[model samples]
Each structure stands twice: as C-alpha cells, then as structure tokens.
Target: MAETTVAEVMAELATLEDPRTREVNEKHGDDHGVNLGKLRAVAKRLKTQQDLARKLWDTDQTAARLLAILICRPKAFDRDELDAMLRAARTPKVHDWLVNYVVKKTLHAEELRQVWSADPDPVVASASWALTTERVAKKPAGLDLAGLLDVIEAEMKAAPDRLQWAMNHCLAQIGIEHAEHRARAIGIGERLEVLKDYPTPPNCTSPFAPTWITEMVRRQQVE
Candidate 1:
C-alpha cells in the first residue's frame, strides 16, 4: 500500500462526521461488531495527530474508550491521566485497561518510565492480547528494567506457560526496536523458549520497529 498521511486519515475521520458513515458505524456498535481494524487505524493515525487525538480523548470519553478496547485508544489521552490510571488501577482487568496499554505504546520514554516506576500490578495474563499491562510490553526505553524483570520472574513462578507467551511478545517487540542494543539489553539476549522465532504478524506492521509504526493497524488479523 502507498504511504498513508495525516491528511488522508483526517479525510477518513471526517467521514465519521458524515451522517451515513456514522450511521453505519453506529449500526455496527455491538462490541463484537465494531471494526477493530479500523479503530486500530484510528489509533495509529492518532499517534501523529496528537492535537486531534487529545480532542477526541477529552471531548468524547465513550468514543475514546471504544477506540481503546477496539483500537488501542488510550495512546492519545493526557499523560497525567495515563499515569494516574496505571498507578491507581486495582486490578489488571479494570475498566480502562486497554486504554492504558495503548497509552503505554504511545508515551515518550521518560514518561513511560514514570509509569513503570509507579505501576503496582504484579502479574498480568491475557491470552488474546500481547500485554495490555501498563509499562511491560509497550514502553520503548527508560523503564525500570530490574523491576520489570522482577515482575516477569514472579509471573513465571506463578504461572510459567501463560506468562511465557506474553514474554515472547514483549521480547519480539524489543528485538525489532533496538537491534543495536540487543547485546546489553536484559532478556534481549536471553531467549524465551516459547517466544523464539515467534511469528510476526504478516498483515500488520511489526510491533517492535518504530520505523514500522504506521497510521493504521490490521486488527482483523492475528499473528
């Protein structure tokens, strides 16, 4: 596909303003019926249009939540709110868990670190998602590597098989990002046997590479 630009995305978003598109989308409002792939595209596009994303997150909380669960919606929310949600979460399956995950992927390194430092959830396991937990699977750098290690270790002790898949997903993204730093990066060198040669989503951009970060995500697919 040719490169998708912010303006192109805006054109599509503008369509949402159209009564027909909105009617179609609204008609498909059943949580399962909503086009998650389209929403992921919305999230990916939002990565570039921060101002527009902020307005969406602030002005339409329900729409934002909808985008998050179906689209990685929280990436565009205010940083303060993102951090607060992470630190204050009582359970991994809280109402806004997906929002926090999207935000984790979208945050700057320092801001992401603050989230890791403050995050309290000990272990997270999601069969469907890679790791929607705050700072574990998404943040690029400046995280408490040691603390993350502890959490993963604890997770392994608690349930090795399940957490191992999440670990694999995490390592895959890391490998794709800092190809140069793979040597010094903790666990980057260590192979998570379960995750070894984990398949990259053929249809979606590889999650590890910033270069591959795009204005759309193929959510209809499963890697």
Candidate 2:
C-alpha cells in the first residue's frame, strides 16, 4: 500500500460506504459500518495515524470513529484527553471499541482504570470494568481480585445498565481465570441472577456469570 494522506483515507472510506451495513450497524449501536475488513486494510496501511485520528474522532462519525480508534496511538493522549474521549463515547459499540482498542491498549491503562473505576459516571465505570476484565484474563498479578469480587457481589444488582454488563463480565473473568474465586463468583452470580433472563442464542451458554465461566473453561480445555 502506498502512503496515503488522511484526506485520501477519508475519501476511500466514503467510497466504501454501505447503507445496508449502516442500517444493521445502527441496530447494534453504531451509526455506520464501513466494513471491518476495509477498516483493517486502512489501519494496516496507515498504522498509528495519530493526527488523522484526532480529527476523525472529532467528526463523531461512527465509521470514522472506528478507524480513529484503530489508528490512534495509545500514548497520543494524556489521561484527561482519554477521559474526555471515554465520556464522548455515545454508543455501546463505540465505547467497547475505545475500551479494547484505545484505553486497554495504552501504557497508562492501569492508572486510568483505578481512577475511572471509582468515578461516579456509569460510562467511565463501565470502561474501567472492561479493562479490568482484560487484566484479569491476561495478567492477574497485583490486582485486588478479592476487593473486585466484593464490590461485584455487593453492587452488581443495583449497578447502572452498562456498569452491570461490565461488572458481570468481570465476575465471569474472575471465575474463569482465578480458580480460588470460581465458586465465590458463581455463588454471587446465582444470588444476583445476573443475565439469567437475557435471551441466549442456540448453542450459546447463558451469559450469567457461572454458566459463562463454565463455557470459557470448556473452550480453554478444547484449545
């Protein structure tokens, strides 16, 4: 791929637009979906287009924002800027992308998580829990897992909707990754009835923490 300016990339994005994909994406919390494959191609070609990312993120176009999240260097923004970005995430899909691709990928992630987890804003707290889950899955060292489970057990039932999703995810990750916490996490899930009534697809395990944890363990065993 030849070097391409941000303008050229934006033009390419325009050409790749699919209204049908946009419609489906909006149903799933995005304003648009310029195919993921195309986004990958562009990201590969323009790795860490930080300047472009800032401009694209400001546009707030969902497709452009997805590309922005992909191309931005994690270190490009300081904590305040990242906090603002998290606050700007207006949709769940965008928030998830920012958590996974931007915030969790940063060197400053742990520091930010500590602050955000304690924040009063539900979106900020949700992002913190998302990062916490990743940390639990990959590197459990130094994390106060017991404290996390205590909070989840106490507050999950009354958490804001987004926070509840992430708190449940954290619970599941704890059960899957830390054997000591498995039974305790499952007990909490049973008590809270987390996602017990949420619809699950055929062949998919329930998203309730215990069942979700078991499904993860089963997959790990197969792998």
Candidate 3:
C-alpha cells in the first residue's frame, strides 16, 4: 500500500468543505469548513505520521494544520519549533488544538508557559493562560493563586478579546478549584464584569466568572 501524500490529504479536505460550516467558523475567526469529527476520522486513518504531519502543517491550510496536530508526535517538536508553530497559528481553532493537543503534551510546556505568559501578543498570552488554568485545576501547589487574581483584576478588563477570555477562564478555575482564593476570584469577577452579560444557551453554565465559579462549586458540593 502507498503512503498518503500531502497533496492527497489536501484534496480530501477540499472535498469536505461546507459553506455553512465555513460561515459559522469564520464568525469565530477560523477559516476552515471541515467538520471536526470528519477531520479526526482522517487523522485516525492516517495515524502517527510525523513526516506527513510536518508536510501537512507546512501547507498552511487551517484544516491541514488541524490534521497535522492530531497526527504528529507531540514530543517530537523542540521548544523553538513549538514556539514557531504557535505564532504561525493565527486562527482560533488551530491555535487552540496546537496548545491543547500538542503543546500541553510536550516536555517544554512549563517553560513555554512562562515565556508566553509575558508575551506582548495577546493571542500568545491567551495560550499561556490556558496552560495556567490547567495547572490551577490539577496542580495548585506552589502556584501563587492570589497573584493570579491580582493580575486578572488589574489587566483582564482592558485586555483584547482573546486574552480577556483566557484570563477569565483562569479566574474561574482559580475560584472553582481553590478554597483559599475563591472569594477574591469571585469578587474580581464581579468588579471586572467581563463576559458578565454574554448569552448562554439553555442548561449551559455561564462563562461569567462568578456564575461559573459558583455553579461549578455547587456541583462539587452535590457530588
């Protein structure tokens, strides 16, 4: 059997584009129209093909890059390569998958997290906050939860949309996971009022920090 080529995968993704999907994705700053479920199925069939993943990523098409993240070995990338990839991933979904799927699994995550947290680029800083939120939930020791609250209080309100949202998630996670910082986190959310009026669908928990923190805490108590 022949190995799949980048051209072949690109053609396949071209065939999977949906107009409505593209419309919806574009509203959120993603350019791809390929359904994620279908894209994952393609990755499953392709399996772990690092060379092929590199080829696909170099194509710079959003769907191909998404597929690349799925197929590549996360640990194969060095710090510089991962940093380059994150900067190149300008769109929302690709940036997200790279952070969540690839960067998070790498040995370099913590180092990159510290570097990106102070980045001048809000998109990059957002990725750092995403990583920090993970630690807040799963590994809270040694992290300055109060310091995080202080930063969120000072900067989150005026932040760009992506950075603001990421900071808000960190705030909510700190409130949800840490008993010591819960009150301060909620209080910061109340004052900042970021995402306070964002519409949430029926039965969905609000992303607004105070509401999100309270609801998650309530669920924890019930559990």
Candidate 4:
C-alpha cells in the first residue's frame, strides 16, 4: 500500500469540516470544525506516521494538528519539540490533545512538568498542573501535596481560567485520593469558591473542588 501523504490527509480533513461544529467550538476558543470522532477514524486509517504527522502539524491547522497528535509517535518528540508544540498550540482542543496524548507519553513529561508548572504563561502552566494532577492520582511519593495546596490557595482564584481549572483539578484529586489532606483541600475549595456555581448537568460530577472531592470520596468509600 502507498503511504498516505500530508496533502491527501489535509484534503480528507477539509471534507470533514462542519460550520455548526466550528460555531460551538469557537465559543470555547477552539476554531476547528472537524468532528473529533470522525477525525480519529481518519487517524485509525492512516495509522502512525511520524513524518506525515510533522507535515500535518507544520500546516498549523487545528484539525490537522489534532490529526498529527493522534498519528504521531508521542515518544519521538524531544523536550524542546514538545515545548515548542505546546506554545504553538493556542487553541483549547489542540493544546489539550497535544498535552494529553503526546506530551504525557513522552520521556520528558516530568522534566517539562517542572518547568511548565512555573511558567508565566497560564495556558502552559495549565498543562503543567494537568500533568501534576495525574501524578497526584498515580505517583505522588515525592510530590509536596501540602505545598501544592498552598499554591492553589494563594494563586488559583486569581489565575486565568485555564490555569484555575487545572489547579482546581489538582486540589480535587488530592482531596479525593488522600484522606489526610482531604479536609484541607475541602477547606480551600469552600473558602475560595472556585467553580462553585458553574452549571453542571444532572448526575455529572461538579468541577467545583469541594463537591468534586466529596463525591469522589463517597464513591471510593462505596467501592
């Protein structure tokens, strides 16, 4: 079989765009119109193609970069490359997919986590906190949970929306996953009131840290 070229992939993506999808995504700061499920189907057909992925990403189209992240060899990107990609990925969905899919799987995750957590760019810092949240849940031996709470208490309420949401997730994770720190996490959430009134669909877990922490803890207890 012939290798799929970037031109071919881009042409296919152009066919997937929907104006309605773009409208909804635009409300959330994403510009792409391609339905993600359909995009993933395209990636599945193409399989991993690091060379093609680079070409797709270089095109700087949201849907193309998204396709790039899905099809690229995550571990193949070096620290600098991932950092550059994160900075370039300004849209919500592209930034998110790159971090969650590619960066998280890279060998430099922890290294980048340390650097990006303190980044002045809130969007970049949000990625750091997201990585931290994963560590808080899975591998938290050396993590300063108390220090994290302190930072969240002081900075989260005043931080930009994306950074605040990331910090809120970390706070909720600590509260949900660790019994000793649960009260402090809840206390911080209650006092700060971040996402306290954010709309939530029925039966969905609220992103408000206190409620999120409590509900998750209850589920754990039931289990």
Candidate 5:
C-alpha cells in the first residue's frame, strides 16, 4: 500500500465528519464530530500513520486530534514532545484523550507523571494525575500510594477543575482497586469532599471518591 500523506488523511477525516455528532459535540465545546469507528477505519488504512497523526494533532480539531491520539506512535514521543502535546490540548476532552490514549501507553508515563504532576500548568498537572490514576487502576507495583494520597488530601480542593477531577479519579481508583488502600482512600475522599455534591445521572454512580468506592463495594457484595 502507498503511504498516505497528511493532507490526504485529513481530507478523509473531513469526509467522515458527522453533522449531527458535530452539533452535539459543539454544544459541549468540542469542534469536530467524526465518528470514532470511522476514524479507526481510517487509521487501519494509512501507512506511516504516525506521520499523518502528528500533522493532524497540530491541526487541533477535536475529531482529527482524537484520531491522532489513536494513531500516534507513543515511542516516537520524548517527554518534551509528550509535554508539548499535553500543553497544546486546549479542552478537557482533548486533554483526556491524550492522557488516556497516548500518555498512558507511553514508556515515559512515570517520568511524565512525576514532572507534570508538580507543574504549575493545570493541563500538565491534570495529565499527570490522569496517568497516575490509570496506573493505580491497573494495580501497578511499587507506586507511592501514600504519597499520592498525601497530595490529594493536601491540594484536591484547591487544585484547578481539571486537575481536581483527575486527582479525585486517582483516589477512587485506589479505593476500588487496592484493598489495602481502600480505607484511607475513602477517608481522604470524605475529608476532601471533592465532587461530593455533584449531581449524578440516573443509574450512574457519583464520581466522588467516597460514594463511588462505597457503591462499588456494595455492588461487589451483592454480586
């Protein structure tokens, strides 16, 4: 198969854009509406997809950028390159896609987590906490669980919105996945009271750590 140029890949993405999805996503502040399945189809077709992925990410359109996250070579990125991508991501959804899809898969995740978690930039900090949250969810060995709890306890309330969300997520993961840390995670959640009152959609557990942990534990008991 012939290598597809970035321009050709972008045109393909434009062809896949869904007007209704775009409208719905735009209401939530994201600009593009390409279907995920369609994007994956496009990913499956391109040769040297990472080259196209880099250019697409630079476009910063949400749908194209999401495709970029899906296709980009994690190994191609140094910490600086990853940091730049995190810094360039303007919206929460984009930041999240990059963290979950790109950063989480990278070898530099721990290194990035340590550096970005302490950065003053909220986006960078959010990405760090996000990576850490995923790490906890997967029950990785030798994590500084105590140190993480300390940070959450100390700064969750005062952290920026996106960063606070990711920190709460980390706390929840620890509670849900790490039996030894569950009690302290709940304690931290109770003390911090992060997202305690956020309205939950019907049939969805609250994302607040204490409630989330309690509800999951209850479900496990019944099951």
Candidate 6:
C-alpha cells in the first residue's frame, strides 16, 4: 500500500485546487482505506466546495474513511458536514463508532431513524447495535429499495458463477433492510441452495443463506 503522512496528505489535498486532481480525488476517493488520521487533518481545513462534497455522496468506503477522520477530530468538520459523513457511511461499524465516541450517543428516536435510513452495506448493517429504543425508527423503509434490489439482482444474473457469491452478499443486505425485498432474497437463496453456490462478493465475501440475510433484517423485525 502507498504510505503518506498527515502533513503530506494535507499538502496533496491542498495542491488539489487543480480541477483535474480534485476530480481525480473525488473519483478515486472511495478506494482510500482506513486513513482516519489523514482525513481528520483534511477536515480540519475543511474545503468549501459544494461540488467536492457532492462527489462523495453515498460512497460507503470513502464515506467511512471520511467519517473516521472527522470522528477522530470532531472539531475539524462542521456539525452538518460531520453528520453528512456519518449518514454517508450507513455502515454499522462507522455508525456505532460515532454513537459511542462522538455524542454519548443518546440520540432520540427520530435521530436514530435518520441514521438507520442511511444507504445499505456493512455500515448500515451494523446499525443493529444502535437499537436503543423500544421502537427503532426505520430510515429507509420508504426508500428506493426496489431500485437498489434490481441493481443487485441484475448483477447476480449477469455475473459468472465465480462472481455470484459476491453479488449475493450485496443483495442479502437489501433483502433484510427492506423486508418486502427479503422474499426475493429468500427465493434466490432457495434456488442457490439447490444450485450449490460458491465464491464470495467483491467488496465483502458474505454468503447467501436464511440467517445470512443479516441483523439489519432482524432488527427491523420487532420494529
């Protein structure tokens, strides 16, 4: 992996005033992994570009990287920017990490719901740990889940057997978070059970099974 210091990353980011570099940074931003220290330094000098922020929208890995940076140095990002980064993660690890460390995490019902409604992935899946209230608000219940499901389903069908498992994991999260979609996942799993699946997904290697639908599903159950 390429190594960079906090100062270096900041300097590189500073020189990123060039539109191409900035655009390149935005395009490849999602691939930067676990650089909490670096992101914090950048957030400390938060950029004022509206277009820059829009670029990172809904990107889980890049969002998580940014979230880690801000959480490590909460004062760096504005309250709204920090919240936007957190919402971008929608990942369980990033969400819980923020809740536990950032605010004594004593969020009221609606606040937590807004958090849950974040985009799906390991980020959103980990939200099970955030179930602090009797009725956990569902953020994405009315979301465009159908579209997300369709995207994954098409990928699964189009992909080769080697890529099938990887696609299943992505679909699996959608299945649980969106209950109506779970039946499709369940149906696919039933078929896969007979077909005997193999290989894992691209970003994550989660499998396809009844229990594999995940905590995101189970949490939404009682609510």
Residue runs of model 5 more than 4 Å from their true location after superposition: 219-223
Per-residue alpha-carbon lDDT of candidate 1 for residues 73-176, written as tens digits (9 for 90 to 100): 44555667655544433323332344345543555424444444333443323322243333434553555444444454445334444345454444444434
Model 2, span 1-223: residue lDDT tens: 6655667777889998998888888886777758888887988878877888898888887778888998888877888898898889888878998988888877889998888988999878998899899999998899999999999999999988889999999999999999898999999999999798989999988888989998898899999
Models sorted by TM-score, best on top: 3, 4, 2, 5, 1, 6
Give the runs in model 6 whose Cα sits over 4 Å from its true position: 1-34, 50-170, 193-214
lDDT of 4 by residue, 1-223 (tens): 8888888888899999999999999999998899999999999988999999999999999999999999999988999999999999979889989988998888899999999988889999999999999899999999999999999999999999999999999999999999999999999999999999999999899999999998988998899
lDDT (Cα, tens digit) per residue for candidate 3, span 2-82 = 999999999999999999999999999999999999999999999999999999999999999999999999999999999
TM-score of every candidate: 0.35, 0.88, 0.98, 0.98, 0.85, 0.32
In order, candidate lDDTs are: 0.42, 0.87, 0.95, 0.94, 0.83, 0.46
Kindly list the per-residue Cα lDDT of model 5 for residues 1-223, writing each as its tens digit: 6766767777877888889988987776677788777877776655346777888888877777887887788788887998888888876678888888788877888899889977988868888888888788775687889888888899899987778888898899888888898999999988888899998999999998999998988888899
lDDT winner between candidates 1 and 6? 6
User: Which 10 residues in a row give candidate 5 its minimum summed lDDT?
Assistant: 40-49
The most accurate candidate by lDDT is: 3
Give candidate 2's TM-score.
0.88
**Candidate 5 versus the native: TM-score?**
0.85
Q: Give candidate 1 regions above 4 Å deviation.
A: 1-31, 38-64, 68-77, 85-109, 123-165, 173-223
